[model samples]
Target: MTHAETAGAPAGDVATEQASHGKSSLPLLTLGAIGVVYGDIGTSPIYAFREAMAVRPGVAATETEVLGLLSLIVWALALTVAFKYVFFVTRADNNGEGGTLSLMALARKTFDKPPVWITALGVAGAAMFYGDAMITPAISVLSAVEGLELVAPNMSRWVVPITLVIILGVFFVQRFGTGKVGVVFGPITAVWFLVMGSIGLYHIVQNPFVLWALNPYHGIEFLATHANIAFVVMGAVFLAVTGAEALYVDLGHFGRKPIVLAWFGLVFPCLLLNYFGQGAFVLNVGPENVVSPFFEMHPDWALGPFVALATMATIIASQAVISGVFSLTQQAIALNLLPRMIVQHTSQDQRGQIYMPQINTIIMIMVLIMVVSFGSSTAISSAYGIAVSGIMVVTLALLLVVMRRNWKWPLGGVIAFGLLYLVIDGGFFAVNSAKIVQGGWVPVAVALFVSLLMVSWMTGRNRLAEKTRRDEVPLEFLVENLAKKKPTVVPGTAIFLTSDVEGAPTALLHSLKHYKVLHEQNVILTVRTSTSPRVPDDEKVTIDAYNNLFFRVVVTFGFMEEPNIPKALALARKLGWKFDIMSTSFFLSRRSLKLGQKSGPIRFWQDRLFIRLARNASDATEYFHIPTGRVVEIGTQLII
Candidate 1:
């Protein structure tokens, strides 16, 4: 069945089922949530405060300015992360999966036809994630290692080189998987948060006046009165909530309850205490202490050890985003937003633990370039917020649709909610936009390139599918003709993989034209990606026998799943097809595409790029997990 055929069942049921499954293991899930979901946002304190203080580069930050900035950061976290994501956006998940793409999938189901705008938003959001993936490690590790300057001034020059080394090490270990070290990520991060809170609490006691920043009025007054400096300061202040988006993005791994419980119970309070503590310590000592306020608060004896802890926290943060990008790439490929790449599952027990060498290498190169070019955490901070801000805005837009359609919220309520958050998200995006000349252009440029690449792939794939459907013979016709004038029947079953289930596959056509024989049993197999995140095993395969000679089979895998054709095909036995894997041959068409004489829907350059992408796509046999010994590839040349 197609998506439309399967849409009869309620969508939220899967999410509810997924939620219930995590209830028995709530404590463990919450711990894992704290480790993975909060890792990125958890490390914000290292440089967020210092960057906010540097709004006026040479001048010492005044008490009002410090309080005001602290107020802005706290409110941003409260409204943006706490309220918008935890309380609301998570409600719009697609079959227990959350992310821009997941939300887009949910929203797309509301309409009879998939909306182009929703797709564009999803593509744009996913593209921006790559930018975030690259900058996250560079900025995070650079900020953490810069603490060496506080431990020993001479080590300041080693910050960039050391950052590069740490990043290299992080990517190198990815192939081995994080499952082994993942056990400690939670306890370590929890300890890190507690220590941050403890240090903050100690300073807040010394200078209770800093607590005044907790009031929202200070944040509002600062924005209203300091118009000249507020814009630049707003961009810097956003660093505090940079990793907040990860909460919604990783919603599928750990369910909603555990994530919410972990946040409200521990992560949220610890962050507030630490931020307030930094504020108090800066006010008590002097604004000059703001140079490295996170490290400054630590006792001389603990600075080295604390710096090491911070480095660990940052590496975990980096790992979280890197894993996230790999997941995003998988989702994109399943949806056909990008070309296929190698996805290696590193752990048998954990379905989500995956490593993509191409994505890892690409991110490593980009991160090293940014670290070498920016040279400091403070410098690279300019590029940090743009992609995140853009993603927030996209997620918010998609959420409005989900509210109006999926949740059955009134149009008025949806509008009111959208307007409220739009201003907040729009304000951050607007402020971050000002940093383009100051290195923000890097992510923006990367996003544009990636978006174009996605658009090219989607457009070209659609065109090719249309052309193939037009040119191919209908399966019904083929079955009728074969029955009338039978060719020599071969001994075993032959499964021809195709994009269109209704049509005879290209590989089957080529084999018959050259060899003049049909297999004793022929199967027309179509693998589909469902809108939901995961399909149940029982519903994975549907077998439709057109005649004894040909069977039309549709194997549906959810977007978040890795497709294993052999395993899925084994399910056909339940439908009365005598399955024998060793005797079956899986036939695939390998298309060698070239530029056509006349122009197509896409421009010449985009067409060429699309051809290039098609050529580099991962081998279908390996991607589909078909046994190499039983796979046969038929080459076909095509003009785009």
Candidate 2:
């Protein structure tokens, strides 16, 4: 079972307070949100408008079609992003953190016993996000770099090679951390948005007739009139709202007010103006100019500079998603959705700044493969919207549960609200699913593979825990037997780590069976992962007096936290445990698995995969930051 499956106490006031304390200036936070949270959507204008206009291969977009497409794009932004995410979904945060998994945690906390469907939805959403993660970097960078074809006609061939180099550089710099480089991300993105709005406004003045697209009738009319190609157009139209999920995912980084203000004050208006501007430009210029209208907006002198700016903006967009993937992986490990991997803290002051080599390398490889396979931005754009659309639909489904259960909305209102957004999000999902034949299968395959890996790990761990429980002696039994027959008492403390505090640790049992000695102070240390994002220091350690010589220690950490046994043990002192690192010995169990004789073909293959994953997982001592010299490992054999 996942840690979220077993956790009961809900973290509310403390988590919220921790999230809000020592707040940055509202303006600064707003700027940061614009830079990081809106990067993907901000860069959409570079390709979104061009893609929508180029739906018919040889035909130029007529004034009617331009207005219709623009209207569709406008309403999509207002409804899906502004209405659903900003105004409504942001309110359903889990103790000030928001995401698919965080929403899952919140919804699960609302009920006495969470339904199985909730976990399914959360896992599906997260898996789909990995699909988005891979495609966003490929498409965003390719679209931006493709502008080089406009800067110098002869430079077209270099786009792919240059893009690969830049991408590799971005991944290479990830180990060094983003603290210094991240400082300029907000200012640069801020300028990009302003440029977008300015260029868009200039075009709107040149072709004032394009403003007619703002009418909802145009959008509805376009959809009705273009029945045959509506599905394809809708998928392209969704490219406009690609990065909307970032607003909710990065909620914990910058609070709701900053994000909300950034959206209204800058990002939203700029995006609308840019999209409208692109529409107006397409109408003013003839069909010939539709191919690279964004670059065409600039004069020859500014074309190179504009391309450079767009490249930077695209890189920033890619950076945001990459960091988001890292964050999500940390949450997955803590929730027990995946096995433990090495997580390195990149910043001392910023807890969220972490680096996972395994994830980084894997994403780099996948992204590079995507870039090479698709070759061009327009080709890869065919694969972009499907995963994001799936995520949006899943988010709305999970939000329905949150509305009724957590928000306590009346049944009628909840149903009405859910049904409305469901149609909108579901429509996007349906249309995008049509792109699967045109290279969209890449993300679908990635999502399915990740989902299978996650489910396998969770299932295998649960079965392993069950087997361990059956094989091990109960903690009470061990304590009672030790009380009756005293063993040679060692001088110092021995802390045996275990998942089940009620049962004797395998390491502890082995020590008694082999060396035949017990420490003066025996601690049954159990590390628990909470459903919330960050646990307060005061609530980190909970101690129970099991007996005179033995005690139980449960160190509770939020999923976002990196576990450190020594630091948590230091916190134990505040709760009356005199924890001394030098004199303490940490004991851990190392399991060597053997396939079960009763397993069938499918079960046997899954067991094999799980065992390989277990073998590759980071050691408990390293993952928990236990001192190496003071640790002891006991080996044991187990059958799946």
Q: TM-score per candidate, in order?
A: 0.97, 0.98
For model 2 the TM-score comes to 0.98
Q: Quote the lDDT for 627 in model 1.
A: 95
The local lDDT score (0 to 100) that residue 560 gets in candidate 1 is 87
Q: After superposition, how far is residue 572 of candidate 2 from its true place, in Å?
A: 1.3
The number of clashing residue pairs in each candidate reads 0, 0
List model 1 lDDT by residue over 1-640, tens digit each: 0111233233563455364354447788888889999999999999888888878546666778778988999999999989999999877777778898888888888888877899999999999999888899999899889999989999978888899999999999999998999989989999989999899999889888888988989998888888888899999999999998889888888878888999999999999999999888887788865578899999999999999999999999999999999999999998889888999999997768999999889989999999999998888998889999999999999999888888899989999999998899999999999999999999999999999999999888987888888989997898899899999998999999988867889999999999999999999888888888888788899998888899888888888888899899888888898989999999889888878888845578888888888888888888888999999889998887
Residue 65, candidate 2: Cα error in Å is 0.8
| Best prediction by TM-score | 2
Candidate 2 lDDT at 107 equals: 83
